[model samples]
Target: MAILITGGAGYLGSHTAVRLLEKENDVIVMDNFTRSSAEQINRITAAAGRAPEVEDGDVKTKEDLERVFQKYNVEAVIHFAGLKAAGESVEKPLLYYRENLQMTLCLLEIMEDYQVKKLIFSSSAAVYGNCESMPVSESTPKNPINPYGHSKAMIEQMLEDIAQADPAWQITALRYFNPVGAHPSIAVGENPAGTPANLMPILLEAAAGERDAVDVYGTDYDTKDGTGIRDYIHVMDLADGHIAAAASQKHGFHVYNLGTGRGTTVLELINMVERVSGKHIAWEAKARRPGDPAENWADASRAERELGWKASCTLEEMCLHAWKWKEEMHKNTQKGE
Candidate 1:
């Protein structure tokens, strides 16, 4: 039996693919090279020391999904195929809803047809938009404020309904916090095709002199140091959480927050990057972005108790690894790698 990773060329998907490959599982990567590239599959191979069979296709197309299901003995799926920028989703709500929802619906239909019920969804902490508490739990009322978060919450509800109706399906939705850093190999990291929407990448850009300065969004959000606080877990740890969810013996649908229980402020993140990269990162305070919360961490005890998974990397290690990856990418670019 093989595991089919939709969007396996993406940042989170590629890291998860590497982890799965290291475990000696047959991994078939299906991607259309939209936000990622075919060369990412090669990097996955270099990182894991094993190659995954690549299928060039989009998840929105049923024919493409059906072909993969027919071609492989796909026993499980780790779904990471979706547009993930909250700001972009805000600007293009219709596109986000159509593409994100359509792709999942198509993938689910194909899974049902193939009788392959095991799935691990790539969810996000954005679903817990502006929670009333610190350290949001699985039971927190999913009151998503943005179109992107709404898409994720909608999919989680859909999965719950499907699992409730059928006892044969095993689905787990992992609500990830900010997944920063990269794999230790530095071969596979978060390198988006166009502009990056995440924090770490933008910070690295400013540190590398690729940009003028990092925009400190919302410096008066009632957080310590007057900046927003978030749970920034390393990308590798997030990848391992998917592996644990796949290995879980539990039946029925479930949701787990893949994050460190601690929170870090935006200012602290900037300082850490500067300290690690040995460069001064200039920043300018800006007005708060709409729908951004003051504090958002995770209550990850359930994942530990149920899936035997917990984040192990520290913030310092996260910054160090990400800096190393950025430096390596620069050298490769200069050397024409």
Candidate 2:
């Protein structure tokens, strides 16, 4: 029985694939390689000493998914294939919906056709748009402020509806907090195609001279340092949470918050990265982007109680591993040049 992972070559997807492979699970990776790469599979192979079968295809194209279903003995799926940028999604709402929601619908249809019942959907905390309280719980209201979050919320509801209709469908949506950092090996991690978006990556890119300077979005928000504060969980910890969710005994539609249950401000995170990487990073303050929140962290108690998992990595560890990967990638690029 193979676990099919959509967008298995992506940042979070690839990390989850590595963990699944390490657990001795037969894995099938389906990706379009638009915002990913086949080399990610190579890194997975190196890390786990085993790699998933790669299907170079898109989920929106039902034919590609059909080919994978027919070829492999898929038992469960972890869907992560989609455009994930909230800021970009604000500019192109239709594009986000067309790719994320439509592809999810196609995957669900194919899974039903193939009689695959188990699914673990990758979700985001943005669904709880600007929660009035701190440490948002799983019961947080679904008030997405942007197109990207709305797309995720819609799919989550669709999964809920499906679960209600069928009792046997095992589904769990892991609403992830800010997923940062890289694999410790420096062999596999995010491969930025251009300028990075997230804080950790952008900070690392600046340290490695890949970018001019990191832009601090929203410098006055009434937080520790007036910058946006978020729960920055390491990618590996998030991957482990997915594994726990997949292996859980619980059934029906469920939601779990995978986070460190702590908030770190932007300036605080930048300081940690600088301290860990030993690089005097340069940064500039910029206005708050649309759909941005002042402060948001997770009340991940549900995941701990249900999945028997919690993020254990420290902030320094996250910064250290991320910098290692960034430096290694920069060295590789220099060699290529």
Candidate 3:
């Protein structure tokens, strides 16, 4: 039985694929390569010690996904394919809605056709929408302010409805905080095209000398450092959480927050990256972006109690691993030409 990973060439998807393959699971990757590079597929193959069955197609297309399901004995799916830029989602709301929602719907139909009952969905903390309290729980209200977040929330609702209508489906919606760090092997890491919208990638580029300076989105938030606070969880830890969720015997729909349960401000993150990478990060404080939360962490007790999962990596460790991967990426680029 193989695990099908949508967008397996993307950052989080690739990392999760490595973890899955490490556990001796047969893997099949489906990606359109619209924003990802073929280099990522090769890197995943190198880390996994075997070339994964790669299918070049979009999840939004039924015939394409059906072909993948038929070719590989896919027993489960980890859905990671979607548009994820918060700022860009706001600019192109329809594009986000169409791509994210339609893809999930088509995939669900194919899953039904193939009788694939297990799913691990990639969700976000943005669904909380500027939470009024810190350490948000699953009971917190979902009031997403952006299309990207709204799409996740909608899919979660759809999953719940499907579970209610059927008893055999096992769905786990893992709401993630900010995922930073790279694999310790440094074989693969985030390779964003053009400008990055996430904080860690931008900081990593600045540390690697690919960019001049990083822009601190806001510095007047109500936090320890008066900057927007976020829960930074290591990507490996998040991947572990996914594996645990999939292996659990619990049936029906479940939602768990995968986070460190600790908040790190923008300034704190920059200082940590600078210290770890041994680079001077020249940063400029900029105005707050729309829909930016002042503080958002997670009460991951549910995940800890249920999945026996908790993030063990420190912020410094994450920065160190990310810096190592960035250096490796730089070296690889130099050797390529």
* Candidate 2 residue-wise lDDT, 1-337, digit = tens: 8999999999999999999999999999999999987888999899888878999999999999999999999999999998999888988999999999999999999999998989999999988999999889998788999999999999999999998999889999999998888888777888765666777888887787777778888998988788999999999999999899899866689999998999999889889988987887888999998668898999999899988999999998888888888888888889993
Give candidate 3's whole-model lDDT: 0.90
Best by TM-score: 1
- Taken over the whole model, the C-alpha lDDT of each candidate is 0.92, 0.90, 0.90
TM-score of each: 0.98, 0.97, 0.97
lDDT of 3 by residue, 268-334 (tens): 9999999998899999989988768888999999999999999999999899998898888887788
Worst 10 residues of 3 by lDDT: 45-54
Where does candidate 1 stray beyond 4 Å?
Answer: none
- TM-score attained by model 1: 0.98
Task: Point out the higher-scoring one by TM-score: 1 or 2.
Answer: 1
Candidate 3 has which clashing residue pairs, if any? none
| Candidate 1 lDDT over residue span 1-337, tens digit each | 9999999999999999999999999999999989898889989999999999999999999999989999999999999999998989999999999989999999999999999999999999888888988779999989888899999999999999999999999999999999999899888888866788888999998888788998888887777799999999999999999999999977799999999999999999999999999999999999988767888999998999999999999999999999999988878887898
Give all candidate RMSDs, comma-separated.
1.1, 1.2, 1.2
